[model samples]
Target chain A: MPLSSSHRVSRRNLLKGAVALSALFAAPLIVSAPAAASAAAEQYVASIGKSILVVAGGSQGQMSGKFRNLMARHAAISAIGVFSLGKYRSKLPGSQKSEYYSLIEKFVAGLFVKYAPQFAGNRIEITGSKARSARDVIVSSKVHFASGKAPLEVQWRLLKAGSGFKIFDVRVLGVWLAIQQRTEFTSVIKRNKGDFGALLKFLRSK
Target chain B: MGVLFIDMVGMRDKGVTGLSRLLAAFCIVAATAIFIAPPSTLADGNRIVIQPVSDDGLDEIEEPGLDDPFEGVNRVIFALNDTVDQIVLRPVALVYRTVLPRPLRKGVANFLNHARTPVTLANDILQGDMKRAETTMVRFFLNTVAGFGGLRDIAGEAGWEYHSEDFGQTLATYGVPSGPYIVAPILGPSTPRHLVGRAVDILANPWTWILWDATTLESISPTLGETISARDDALETLDATREGSPDYYVTIKSLYRQNRESEVNNGAVLEEELPDIPDVR
Candidate 1:
C-alpha cells in the first residue's frame, strides 16, 4: 500500500510517456501543419531583423524541465557541439552522481535569470532564417545581454508541435546550452563531490 | 593523447573487424593450442612477442558502418537496459532518495561506499600499519558485496572516502599489457585485456548466481529499479548537454577508446584528493 502512490503515478506516467513517444513518432507529420505557420512567422520576424517580438506560449520551464530530465537520465546533451557524461556513472571510480548534478545545477540556476536580457522581455531582430524541415527552423538573432556583451548571436530551432511551435533547441552563437551542460557539469561535479548529483541538487535548490 | 594513440595503435576501426574475427578465431585456436603448444610454450614468458596487429590510417567513411547489425544488437541491449530502468527502477530510487531517513541513508552509504582504500588512510589510525591486513580484508569484503548498491559513503557521507575495485584497475595490477582498443557490443569501449577482464569479473560476480538462479522477475526487480531511479534523477539534461558531433556513436566510441587508453597509460590513479580516513572499528 505504501508503494501505491508511486505505482499509480508510474502507471499514469508510463501512459503519458507512451503518448509522448507516439507524438515523437508522428511528429514529422503532425508538425508539418505548423511549418507553414511558423515559416510565415519567421518571414515576419526576418524583415524586422534586430527588432524583438514577443511570441507567446513558449515556456522556458518546459524546455528546461525536459532538458534536465534528459540529463538526469544521463542521456547525451548536444548543445552547440560537445559531448560529456550527463549521468553519474563514467569510466572510472568517481562520484558520477555528484558530478552530473553540479553542472546541471549551475546551468539550471542561470537558466532564465542569466538568459532573460537576451530574449525574455526584450525584442531582438531575426536576422536570418534557415528551415531544416517542415518542423525544424533555425532562426538567428542578436541579443544584448544585461551585462551588455555586444549582442551575441542566438540561433533558435523551433519544432512544430500540434497547432503551435515549441522551442526545441537553442544555440547561442553556435554554442548550444545542452552540449555545454555535460562539459561544464562534469568539471564542477568532479571538483565538488566526484559525481553528478551534487550539481542536480545545487540547481534544484536554486 | 590523440596523437599518441593514433601513432601507436592507429584508430579503433582501422582493422577491428578483421582483428576481432582473428581474435575470435584465435581464442578458439589458443584454447586448442593450449593442449598442443608444448609444455615449454607455457613456461616461456620471454617467447611471447607483442606483434603489432595493424596500423592503417583513418579512413573517411563514405557511409561508415554505423548501421552494423552487431551495433543494432548493442543498441537494443542499451535500450533494454534503459527501458528496465525507466519502467521499473526509477520510481524506487526516487522514493529511496526522498523517503529514506537521514541516519538510515547514512548507514546505507557507510555500508555501501568504497570509493577509497584503507592504505590511503594509513597514518590517520593510531594502530597504523598493524591494521593493514585487517583493512585489506575489510576492503575486499565491502567492495565485493556492496559494489552495485550505490551506497558507498563512509559514515553517511555522500561520496566514498577511498576508491572502489573495478576490472580495469585489477588488470593493470596484474601487469597484463593492454592490447589494442576495442568497442564491445552493448558494453562500449575497452581493451582486449580489459575486455577479457570484464568477462572474468562478471563470471566471478557473487551475485551472478542469485541473479541467474533467482526468479527472473525478482532478480531484475532491484537492478531495474536502481537504474531507472538513477535515470530519472538525470533525465532533465540528458540531451541538450551532449557535445558530440552528428556522428554521436563514432564520437562515443572514440572517446571511450581514448579515455581508456589514457586511464591505462597514465595508470589507474585516483584523480581526487581525499582527506585521511579515521580508524574504522
Candidate 2:
C-alpha cells in the first residue's frame, strides 16, 4: 500500500491547487461586499448630478417643462413638503396636505424652469459624494459658467425611497432651498392667522 | 603673595568664610538639580515650589462670548441700508444692468476681480495657506498677462480656480471668535471681529495704498464703480429675495449668518441634516 514518491507528490500538488483556486474565487466576494455598497451610493449621487446637469442644459423655453418632469420623477416632493411644513403638517388634513404638496411641487418646477435656462451652456462637474446614513447621501458639484465666471457650489441631498433615490433638498452657496421656502411659507401662515387655506390660496396665485 | 593666600585659606577653614563656601557649593548643586530634574518628578519632589492650579475654572471664564447680542442695533442699521438700497443703489444698478451689454458687464466684473487678487493673496498668506497663496499669485499673473489687463478672464477659461479670501476668514482660521453680529450702514452684515479684520484688510490692500497716493477723484471712482457693479450683479437675487420673503430683513440676516458660517467651515455640512428652510413666498 506504500505509494511511489512521484504519485504522492502529484496528489499533494493537486490538493494545494484546489485550495488556492477556491480562495481566489472567495476573496473577491469577501472584499467586494463593502466596496459594492459604497459604489452603489456613489452611483446614486452621480445619477442625481447628471439629471440636474441635463435640466440645466435645456433651452430657455423648454427648461420649465424639463425641470417639472425631472422634479416629478426624481425629487421627493412629499418629503420636502412635510419637512417644510414642520409642525403645521399635523394640523392639515391628509387630503389637503396632498393637494398642497402637488401645488408646491408645481410651483417649484415652474421656478426651476424659469431659473435653469440662466445656467444653460454651463458645465456641471460632480465634485464628490458622502453617505450621510443608510438612506441618505449628499452630492457636491460645481456649476462652471461658460462666461468664465466663478463656479458656484451646489449640494444635493438624496434620500432612498423604495427601490430608488429621490432628491429631498438642495443647498446653493450655503442657503438650503427647502429651509428658505419653509420660512416664507411660515411667514404667510402667520399673516393669515394660522389659516392653511390662505396659504393654499397664496400658492395657487403663484 | 603666595604666603598670604595660604594664610587666607587656613583662616577660611577655621571660620565663617568656610561655612559660607560650603553654603555656596550647596546652592550651586541645588540650582543645577532644579534645572536638570524632569518636570513631572519635580512637581512631586517640590510640592511647595510648584502651586497646584486647575485650568477647569479658567476654561469657563475665557470661553468666547461672541454671538448676536445687539440684534436691535443691527436691525436698525439693516433698515437704513435697505432704505439706501431702495432710494439709490437699486435704481442705479438697474440702469447699469440695462445700459451695459452682458458681455461688457462681465468684462468689467472680471477686471475688478483681478484687481482684487492681491488682497486675496495677502489673506491667504496670513491664513498660513501657502498653496492658496501660490495659486493666487499664478492666477493674478495669468490674468494680467493673458486676459489683457484682466478684462477677458482668460485664466478662468484655462481652468484656474478663483479664490476669494478675506481677513475675517484668516482670523477665523486663527481661532478668533466672530464677537457679535452687527449690520453696518452701506457695508451690510458683519461681526465685531470681522469689522477689525476689515480695517486691517483696508490697510493691507494695495488699492487702498494706491488710492491714498492718487488724486481724490481717482480714489473715489474705483470704489464707486465697484459698489455699482456689485449691486448690479446682486440685483436679480436681491429682488427675488425681497419678493419671496414676507419679512425680508429677517430672511437676509439669517441668510448672511448661514453664508458666513458655511465659509468658515469651508462648505462642509451633512446634506441630510441641512435645515429645511422653505423657499415659498
Scored by lDDT, the top model is: 2
Instruction: Tell how far residue A89 is off in model 1, in angstroms.
Output: 33
TM-score for each model: 0.31, 0.71
Candidate 1 residue lDDT tens string, A1-206: 47776566677799999999999999988766555666664764453322222221135555455445433332222221112433322322334444443554446534533343334434465666665555455566655444322344566555444444444445542334443344454444655656445545544555
Model 2 misplaced stretches (Cα beyond 4 Å): A1-38, A41-65, A86-95, A186-202, B1-76, B270-281
Can you list each candidate's DockQ? Answer: 0.01, 0.16
Fraction of native Cα contacts reproduced by each candidate: 0.00, 0.26
Model 1 over residues B1-281: C-alpha lDDT tens digits? 11112211211111111223235434533432232322322221112221222223221111101122234554455455445544544455557767866455544533322322332233123223344435544554555566444354322122222322334434554565444333343233444554554443333433444455566566554333423333333333222223222233433443444344333433222212111111111
| Best-fitting candidate, scored by TM-score | 2
lDDT of 1 at A91: 26
Q: lDDT score, residue A138, model 2?
A: 70
lDDT of each prediction vs. the true structure? 0.39, 0.63
lDDT of 2 by residue, A1-206 (tens): 88888667586798898999999999988756444544565576666666777777766677767777878888888778866655454445677877888888877876675555454535667777666555666777777776656787788777767656778888876767776676667657757876778778878876
